[model samples]
Target: MKKPSRIVNFLYRLVGMSYVHESVSEVREALAEHSVGTVAERWARIHAQGAEKLQHPLDFQPGLIDLHDEMHDMWRYLVALRNQASRGMSAHLADELEEAADFMGEVLHHVGLAAEATIPDASLDRGPGSTWINIPAPPAL
Candidate 1:
């Protein structure tokens, strides 16, 4: 995921934003089932929907439904629970997903990392349903 500006990050933190890196169990579950296709859909969403055209449009969200609806339902759970900042991060992810042509490949490459070691790392050991898509943070400026 692209780095959010300091101001945006602060604002997100100020709002207690539990987004982006936060665990969304549905995504993990979809990954468990569809695996590569789950991440592929996110990439496909960027190509088809184009974050530039719509607001926070994501593969897992409610905007465009090109691939499987199962993924959408997974992210939808997070949408229902989190605030707008969370949704905005979905937009951020979608935007970055477009730029990240090999994103799906990366995720799929690391798919066998015992859950905790997955690309977008989240810990099921953390507690009930604790699974996050920890997109790698950008390098230091």
Candidate 2:
């Protein structure tokens, strides 16, 4: 199996964010299945290619930037869930799955929208279903 740090580095490169050392640690501690490697690599390739075309901006899907942001957010939550599992802390796995479902839903929802409809509402939240659980922030951050 690929190590967590490597998986995170791959995601960071794919997600249009500066790669950080901590992301690897976050992955090691947070993720369980760690079977999303293929998807992560594909996303990274898309992101890196998108970034290369930034200067000739007309060819890009303008919402590529927002996609990167959402990707980063997804990684952040996955890392948290992984960490929670590591520490024997209580967590609602259902909520974690719901959050993932919601994020993926939003991504697909906007994929075919008109350019003018691409902007996401700033007040959007990342919790599952309707209820938001208040988990304490990670100590390292």
Number of clashes in every candidate structure?
3, 3
Worst 10 residues of 2 by lDDT: 132-141
Best by TM-score: 2
Q: How far is candidate 2 from the true structure (C-alpha RMSD, Å)?
A: 16.9
Instruction: Estimate, for each residue in 1-141, the C-alpha lDDT of model 2 and write its tens digit.
Output: 543476787788797865433575666655633435666667667667655644432333445546656765775676666566546554566466557757765665565343323324424734443323333232221
As for candidate 1, its clashing pairs are: 23-131, 23-132, 120-134
Which stretches of model 1 miss by more than 4 angstroms? 1-23, 36-91, 102-141
Question: Cα lDDT of all candidates, in order?
Answer: 0.45, 0.53
Candidate 2 has an lDDT of 0.53
How many pairs of residues in model 2 come into backbone collision? 3
Q: Model 2, which residues run further than 4 Å from truth?
A: 1-27, 30-46, 54-58, 61-91, 114-141
**Deviation in Å, model 1, residue 131 alpha carbon:** 51
